[model samples]
Target: MRVSGEKLDDQQIIEKIMRSLSARFDYNVVAIEERNDIFTLTFEGLMSSLCSHEQQMNKRINSTKLEQALQSKASIGGHGG
Candidate 1:
């Protein structure tokens, strides 16, 4: 099956996607109202985890970019055209 410009294989792919999305949406819609009912929930912890993961990813990406830039600079500076 195909969705817009994307191809979706596997049987019931559309249904599965729709169902999962709908369930997530519904949970989000009701989460705020039922916050008190959800004990042991740590939004702060979740945000901290996400922030740490993002920082590590950014560091890795920047290191790779810096290495590439240095290599390119060396190549260009060492070669006379």
Candidate 2:
């Protein structure tokens, strides 16, 4: 998914988002690419953060990834891909 930002290329933005999602949810984000400003997520990833939810059984299994896909650049690093 894409967040509102400027200058960052699609790949860079996607990389930052994927890292945050992996960290925040503790999920193993296997792969992340980009298409325009939108993103497609693959499922079956794990997230420890969701364990505390009252409704332990999340109907949407992929929500953890969706939740992790935030709309902000926490940070950017390096010029090399």
Candidate 3:
């Protein structure tokens, strides 16, 4: 996402990515490449960190789907499907 209608710099983009990954995660920005307005960030981190992030994301997605399903069910009728 752009800020104030201006494109983010390489460092800004890297910092944003790092924020999502969290500083606690054992990772380092190895390299960055820009092509066709797309910035690619290369990082090296512990396998455990990757796995942990994946698990957390999966849980969030599943929980969101379940919540939506429950809401939809309630809106229609509280009965077994």
Every candidate's lDDT: 0.53, 0.40, 0.56
Tens digits of lDDT, candidate 2, 1-81: 335545775455545655666353433344223232224322222123234431443535467656555422222223333
Clashing pairs in 2: none
For residues 1-81, what per-residue lDDT tens digits would candidate 3 score against the true structure?
676687976657556665566553433323222232224433333334456666887799999999999999897885665
Model 1 ranges with Cα > 4 A deviation: 1-41
Off by over 4 Å in 2: 1-6, 22-28, 31-57, 60-81
List where candidate 3 sits over 4 angstroms from the true fold. Answer: 1-45, 78-81
Per-residue lDDT tens digits of candidate 1, residues 1-81? 364766744423423432444342454325433654223334454345445656876799999999999999999999966
Better of 1 and 3 by TM-score: 1
Measured by TM-score, how close is model 3 to the native structure? 0.42
Task: List TM-scores for all candidates, in order.
Answer: 0.48, 0.28, 0.42
- What's the lDDT for residue 77 in model 2? 27
TM-score, model 1 to reference: 0.48
The candidate that wins on lDDT is: 3
RMSD of 1: 13.3
